[model samples]
Target: MNAIELSHVSTAKPVLLGDSLTELEVMRDVSLSVPEGEILALIGPSGSGKSTLLRMINRMEDPTSGRIFLFGSDIANLDVKELRRRVGMVSQTPALLPGDVADNIAYGPNLRGEPCNPGDYLEHVGLERELLRRPASALSVGQQQRMCIARALANHPDVLLLDEPTSALDRTASRNIVELILRLNEKLGLTVIIVTHVMEHAQALATRVAMLVGGSLIEQGPAVDFFESPATETGRKFLRGELAEDGR
Candidate 1:
């Protein structure tokens, strides 16, 4: 089953007012899909709407004119609250709640009235059980990031959306998190969609890579192919590091 399916998805067009103040058009006719249990990376330069696309997938933002399906159901027609519960997201800066680790991890399940064992999730993320009582702010950056991931997993989400999850981490920490994500995908069959500016990181974690530029999807294919044979000029330039100063 396809975990996510999008067809002709588009954001709102800019509306010009009487005074000629123009609204910015963020996303174009964006469309993509990820099969169940596959890890796909959404790659692009900053402001390319990769994050916007991720948000749309989980209904954090509604598309102006498009359809999104998750787990075989049209997300537009599903209950907003329930749909979110099944799709978890983690961003670059770990948004750990102001509470102990256990409480933070259990927050989602608690809200849903679902039975939760924060310890189980912590273990799944390779954290110690004793850290449950630690305050979220007390852990090192890497540890805190892992805690955030564990918190997301506490809900047993079917699809996980990650947005530049390792941007702030050191090389070692970033590697660890990447390995953990791969392990989670392999062991639990989690369908993961990651948005990343770092091409190397995307290559390391993704089974497939989708490149976006100027709010357009340039190309998407297996990880190896995306790196070796980018189909679009934008992708080729990006892979060659020709757009480094421009942040592409």
Candidate 2:
């Protein structure tokens, strides 16, 4: 079963409002499907709409045209709260609650009147159970990110969306998070979609890769094929590191 899908999804934001509105299309004809238990990395220069497209998944933003499906259901029709729970998201930087580690992890479940143990998810994210009581602010950047992951998992999500999850981590922390992501995909069968600017990190974790630029999908394919022998010049440039993020 497909965990998530976007069919000709397009998003436009109003740039000018007057007698006639001028809108900037941030994403256009973006169609992709994330298979169950697979990892898809979305890579692109900045302002290419990578983050815009990611936000569309849980309805943090909506498409002006086309459709987005989550686990075979139209996300637009699903309850916003429930849709987010089923498809969790973590951003580039950790956003922990103003409390202890356990409180951060249990925040989601507590909202739904469910019980959760910080230990159950800590190990999954390479965190120690003993740190459960530490104040969120006291933990290292990496530990904070893991706490964010644990919090997302507390919701029992089927799909996990990460946007540049390791961009702020040290080399070692980044690698550890990558390993944790793989373990989650394997053990929990979670469908993972990550938006990242770092090509090496994407190469390490993604089964398939999707490239977006100027609000449009340039190409997508197996990671090896996309990186080694790109079909488009733009893609080739991107892979060769000639194109910096932001397409400059």
Candidate 3:
């Protein structure tokens, strides 16, 4: 069964320019499916709505029209907090709370009066347990990102949504994060949807690739086929960096 599905989803925002009102379409009738335990990379040029599309899966941004399903259930019908707990999200930058590492990791479960052992989650993200008491701000950017992943994992989510997860990291840190994501998916059978501007990261992490251009899905297929023999001219142009602000 598909872990997540977007059926005829579209989003638009009203914009006012010089006293004239206009509707800006962010996504246009997009339909996509992600199977269980699969890593699907969402790629496109800047302003192509890749991030917007990812955010919609978790209802961080709701679509103006259409529906989203999680494990065959309509997400709109689910309680928002429960939905978020089931679908964890990690943004480009780690937004840690103003506390030590352990506090940040325990925040989610604490809200529900549940117990959380921070060390176990830290191990999942390849972080040492000794840092549990360290201040969140003291950790390096890479460590902070890993901590964010750990915090999300503490929720025991079925699906993980990552938006530009490695954009701010160095090459070494980025590669570490990619490996960590692969490990989590393998170990926990987590379905992952990642939006990335780096082709190399997508190539290394994604089992399938989906490309959006001008807020529309242009092509999507197995990773090997999409990388080597893209079906559309726009996809090819994106690979060759022909599109303006490509892969941002």
Candidate 4:
């Protein structure tokens, strides 16, 4: 069964100046399902609405029309805070609080009324327990990113949303994050959706690939099929580096 489902999802832009004013449609009649216990990678150009789609999944942005179901329940009717707690997000720039590492990692757990134990979570994310005493802002970018993951894990979430989680890291650090993501999935059976502009990273980690163009899904299927036999001309161009010049 699908863990998440979007039915004829469409998000429109709001009028700014006048009631008749129209904005470009961000997503149009989109429908898809993500199964439990799998990693889905979303790849697209800058204005393709990939981020918007992810945001809608977490209810950060509501859909203009249609419905979304988490498991079997309608997500639009769920409690926002409770739903967000179940679906954790990690952005490219790690947003750490002005506190020690332990505090940062403990924030989510505390908010959820769960036990805040930083040592175990930090270790789970492959960090030393001793680093818990260091200020969150003192860590290097890579370490900060790992701490962000640890913080998310502290919530014991069923799903994780990662947006270019390795974009700021060096190659070594990027590999480490990817490895850690895989390990976390194996250990916790987390359903993960990672959005990245980097094709190589998507190729390396995605169980399934969904490529978007002009705010619509161009191709979506097994990772191998999307990479080997892209359905749309836009997807084909992207794979051949013809569309890499776009600012995405």
Candidate 5:
């Protein structure tokens, strides 16, 4: 079964200037599916609504039209907190709470009146157990990112949505994160949808790739096939660096 599915989804927001109102289209008729336990990468130029698309899956942003489903059930029918617990999201920057790593990791479960051992979650993300007591802010950017992942994992999510996860890291740190993502997918069978502008990272981590341009899905296919020969002109130009300037 598909882990997540979007059918004719579209989003638009109204903008007002003086007495006039204009609608800004964020995504246009985006239909896509992510199979169970698949790692799908979303690539696009800036302003293509990749992050917005990710947010819609977890209802952080609702679509103006059409529907979204998770594991064969309409997400709209699920409780908001339950839906979020099933789909966890991590942003480009770590949004660690102001406290020790242990508290941050336990925050999610505590809200639901469940037990959580920070060290166990930390280990899932490859962090040392000793770091659990340390201030969350004391860790390096990469470590903080891993801690964020651990915190998300504490909720026992089945799917993970990552938006520009490695954008702020150095080459080494980025590589580590890529490896970690691969490990999590292989070990836990978690479905993942990651938004990234880095072609190399996408090529390395994604089994399937989806490309968006101007808020429309232009091409999507196996990573190897799409990288070797894109089906669309815009996708080809994007690969040739013609649209690189517009990428984040």
Candidate 6:
């Protein structure tokens, strides 16, 4: 079964809540399928609703119309808390709570009454055990981001969603996270759906690339074919560094 599937998914919200109340459609009829254990990259220009699409998989925000399935089960019918546990997310700017690294990593598992050893997970995300008691604010941005990944993994998720995970790090740090992602996918058979603006990075890590433009999925295919000769005009322009929308 496909790990995650979106069928005619759409999202709209009030442009002006109190006075105007005009509905602004952020995503329009987005349909895509991600196979189990596949690292699929979601690429798009700014305001293209890529993050919005990612949020829907974990039900961060419900779709205004259409349906989403996680491993053949409708997300709407599943409990929101359980869905989020199964679909872990690591954000672009990770929010480290008012505590040490260990506290952050143990949050989810502790909530579920599961025993969580910070050292084990620290190693799991490539961090040293000595940093367990260090203040979260004291850590570098890269280390904090790794903590976020570890925190997400505490839930023992089947799929991991990463949104611009390496955008803020230096080249070396970015490469660290990239390699770690690939390793986790290979070793654990984890399904990863990563949102990235770096075309080269996507090409390096993803087997397939899905292009989202103007809140719509323009094209998606094998990474080589999609980058070599994109089926859609928008995709072709995007690869040539000429897509209309702005921002990474």
Query: For every candidate structure, what is the RMSD over all alpha carbons to the true structure, in angstroms?
Result: 2.5, 2.3, 1.8, 2.6, 2.0, 2.0
Per-residue alpha-carbon lDDT of model 5 for 4-89, expressed as tens digits?
99899999978796899998898889999999999999998888889999999999989999899999999999999999999999
Worst 10 residues of 2 by lDDT: 239-248
Q: Spell out the clash pairs found in candidate 1.
A: none
Q: lDDT per residue, candidate 2, 23-44, as tens digits?
A: 8888889999888888999988
What local distance difference test score does each model get? 0.87, 0.90, 0.92, 0.87, 0.91, 0.90
Clashes of each: 0, 1, 0, 0, 0, 0
- Ranked candidates (TM-score, high to low): 3, 6, 5, 2, 1, 4
Query: What TM-score would every model get versus the actual structure?
Result: 0.93, 0.94, 0.96, 0.93, 0.95, 0.96
Candidate 1 per-residue C-alpha lDDT over 1-248 given as tens digits, one digit per residue, 9 for 90 to 100: 89998887878546678868676667778788899999999987788788989999988888888789997799988988888889999988998897899999999999978899999999999999999999999999899889988988988889999988899899999999999999999999999999887788888888888877776778888888888888887788888778653345
Tell how far residue 13 is off in model 1, in angstroms. 7.9
**lDDT (tens digit, per residue) of candidate 4 on 1-248:** 77778898888877566657777688888888789888899988777888888899889999889898888789888999888888888988999887899999999878767788899999999999989999998899999999999998888888899988999999999999999999998889998999997888888888988877777777888898889879888888888877753423
How many clashing residue pairs are found in candidate 6?
0
What residue pairs clash in candidate 3, if any at all? none
Q: Name the lDDT value of residue 172 in candidate 3.
A: 96
Which lDDT tens digits does candidate 3 get at residues 1-248? 99999899999978898899999998899988999999999999889999999888888889999999999999999999999999999999989898999999998999899999999999999999999999999999999999999999999999999999998899999999999999999999999999998999899889989999878888878898999989988888889988775333
Error of 3 at 13 (Å): 1.4
What is the overall TM-score of model 6 with all chains considered together? 0.96
**Top of the candidates by lDDT:** 3
- Lowest-lDDT window of 10 residues in candidate 5? 239-248
